[model samples]
Target: MTIEPYQWAVRCPETEAKLAIRGLSKTFGTGAEAVHALVPLDLMVADGDFLCVVGPSGCGKTTLLNLVAGFETPSTGTVRLDGKDISGPGAERGVVFQQGALFNWMNVLENVAFGPRACGESKALAHRKALATLDMVGLKDFALKYPYQLSGGMQQRVGIARALTNDPQVLLMDEPFAALDQQTRETLLAEIRQLWQRTGKTILWITHSIEEALFLATHIVVMSPRPGRVRAAFRSRFNESKDPLITVAPDFVEAKRQIIHLLGQDANKEEV
Candidate 1:
């Protein structure tokens, strides 16, 4: 589809390649009773890129993610993965939700193996691969631990491991750290940074914090509240060093401030 000049969809070259979302819109109910949760949304996430999307509460940010995850469909527009229209969740797009989503009865190894087994992988091979993935996340020692036995951060790590075990090209996260305390959040942020650097999988993260978006993403897309629309986006060039601590640097703070100011601008316009 031909997105208009400078529209959110047309602006991202990444969307031109791997993943393209054009004039994406979603609504609930019908007629005057219907709520337009999102309107003509647009986004393009490139291969091997990290994109973070932030917006006020109830802005349909998760709705957009759900559409791509194939949990729901857009009322208008299209979401395409590699030029093919998205039908449903596939091995290519791995999702890590806010809730660990881990099977309580299963240990780390079992949880990671679930994806491969569902794909028809042999139990032996799947277990072996799962073990390797657990090691990759430095959770091999806790392979036998159930979700209940692990800390919130550890549980989230296992969630990440399970998604990675399938070797997905695109990793979509929905604020996986929202439940954790500050220190734990910071630690996982660093760990996730290293994981992204080592794995090189493109990530599209949904968050509400300007600081988190500026810290973790190479590109940050900020949306306005209710009937969410793309208010602004920024290319956060906070070095390619892969150090999470650099988020405290001057450049990082400035980028975050600018984005926050932009987000506030929309709130102001809406209030007026």
Candidate 2:
């Protein structure tokens, strides 16, 4: 794969931002029927930052992510990547949805390789990249298996692998582990952490689990109930620690409690 000069240039530590969302807001429909999904919100994502967004059910957490991924256009404001306006989806940003949207007709390797090949990589090179990525997600042995043959967690792994095959600078994950059992979710969490450390990719993750956000994010943002706006933003150091017992640490517990309290306050407002 030929890496463009700009792609290599972006990896420079001196670069200030990987993504910039300025007064971004989204609304669906028109007139009285208009449904405002996101209020004007501004955010800057530094290179290699793991940003996790959490909020109540209608708080537009996924809407925010979709904007960054260019899956939806913002009704107001702009989203820029490396200083350029993002008008549509590109290989620079890869996305992993809540469920693995794999093609049942294709085997695991083919599914993962589909992206690279679609991007014009030679079949052999794409297959090689796909296999390497499968190995990263710990699914190398299942390369030939079809989607139906794998469990839910395994399918999600393939979804992750497919996204990685593009070597995207940014990863937008929308509750990728939400469908899994607790055990499988925890396992995938560790793998995702390792992958982030290894690749240093910029990630925007949307999850409902505060514990999961604290465990994975370098930065966290909590949105208000609806017409979602950032109610709070925090920088967390817990994810940097290697201690297995860190989750039980007082600081971690306090942070989680604080976030839960914040969410609860907003939820109460919605009820009122």
For all candidates in order, the CA lDDT equals 0.83, 0.89
Name the lDDT value of residue 139 in candidate 2.
95
Candidate 1, residues 1-272, lDDT tens digits: the string is 01011333455564365788888999999999999989996688777778888988998889988888888888999988888898788988899999899999898899999999999999999999999999998899999989999999999999999999999978989999999999999888878877888888889899988877766777777888889888777666553655546767766666667777777888798889
lDDT of 2 at 192: 92
TM-scores of all candidate predictions against the true structure: 0.92, 0.93
Model 2 CA deviation exceeding 4 Å by range = 1-15
Q: Which of the numbered candidates is closest to the native, going by highest lDDT?
A: 2
Model 1 scores a C-alpha lDDT of 0.83
Deviation in Å, model 2, residue 232 alpha carbon: 0.4
lDDT of 2 at 128: 100
